[model samples]
Target: MATHFEHLHAVSASQAYKATFASHEHTPSSSIKVQCPIEVSFSDDTQTQLAYFLRLLKQASQQSRWVTFIGHEALVDKNLLQSAGIDLNKVLVVCNKKGHSVQELMIQALQSGNSSAVIVTGDILDFTSGAIRDAAILSESFAFVINRQAKQQMTIH
Candidate 1:
């Protein structure tokens, strides 16, 4: 199954894995999990998607959970998230490219064992199935934004 963001033209992390799988033409023998962008970016929107994300984070923070942010876009997201009343330190920003970033950041986050949620760019192929599985296993909750090419690759896989 696909995610809501896919329909909205927003990127999801699973899309990256799907792209990797399709590029290899590997038959998907395992299931994948991905979460869509809670808010989409738009130049004309009355409010910024980032603002919405912040609002969500503020609400989520009432529960007092640690949140992690992954991806280049996450840099901006983290900044906005902090503005919405989340502790700036509570949000972790990942700076690596997809193929290399996910595994490393995931490992660090999992090892830290303090993160309550994660927001990452869609780069599924960056991590082995095992690593992805591990993240799925380890994170209490996670959000992924799948990029456009990921699904095309997945179908090819």
Candidate 2:
């Protein structure tokens, strides 16, 4: 009887573990969207920053939608993207040639449901991250604001 009870407990524990982890797993077709508008930063002095960016971009491209880039065309080279295993056809680099502002473009892309992830790089501040978070939730997508900060230094305004 004790052995039977132990077996049932083991099964229940394993089931709980699976349930806990399944929600955190990323899938292209998953309805449970992840929290978005995640802010990340990298300094020019760091050697591993580009690698981290590539890894994150690769993961974001796993969805059916496009992985869009804004204001970072030089970094999104064909060779680099290919090395990251991201589909070249699914990648987009938009220039700010239009009258619309970069923030405006970011919000639109996040809410359009056409992009799996929208990545921007620059010294973009002064806008509200909450707005991006809301748009991301509405479209069930990811928004990455990659702030290229000062190189291993800080300044006070």
Candidate 3:
């Protein structure tokens, strides 16, 4: 059977594993008890990244759970999402502000039991290692942190 992680379009197995394992050191006898949240970074590929994000969000919403979208104002385009077949009703976009803490909001959203998946877009660097680990352990829901930047190496020379 395919795991929940397998349903994601943008996140690879190695990326997921690294994001999860980067939090702590594990011995040979140690085992991972909880699923690790994924971090996807996009540079100069907003369209492609958004497409993948929407696809993953759609898949997650299949479980009939709300999907929380935390992103900058420019990151989320309602029209794009609509055209991509995303159900607008299932999404709640949280706009990041100057004083507000995105990480804290993410943790609260995950622990609230209302959201099945949390999709965060912006700078991936803002999400610290501790925050990701804490969010992963606190909830069974899937978490994804997306970074939007200009892709520096898209051309093949």
**For residues 34-75, could you state the per-residue lDDT of candidate 2 as single tens digits?**
443434444444334456556556666777888888776324
Predictions ranked by lDDT, top down? 2, 3, 1
lDDT tens per residue, model 3, 1-157:
1133433333432444433344454211122223555655444444355445565555556556677887653234678667767677887877766566777777777877777678775555565455565655566566777654433333322
For 1-157, candidate 1 gives per-residue lDDT tens digits of: 3332223323323343343245435643132233222222322332333444454445334445566666655444445466678777666666765565565676666446565555555443443344444554455334433332432332210
Best by TM-score: 2
Quantify all predictions' global Cα lDDT against the true fold. 0.45, 0.57, 0.56
Model 1 has an lDDT value of 0.45
lDDT of 3: 0.56
Cα error of candidate 3 at position 13, Å: 9.3
Error of 2 at 138 (Å): 1.6
Pairs of colliding residues, candidate 3? 43-149, 43-150, 43-151, 44-149, 44-150, 44-151
What's the residue-level lDDT of 152 in candidate 3? 35
What TM-score, to 2 decimals, does candidate 2 have?
0.64
Candidates' TM-scores?
A: 0.44, 0.64, 0.59
Lowest-scoring 10 consecutive residues by lDDT in candidate 1? Answer: 148-157
Model 3 stretches with alpha carbons more than 4 Å out: 1-34, 44-50, 71-75, 96-98, 151-157
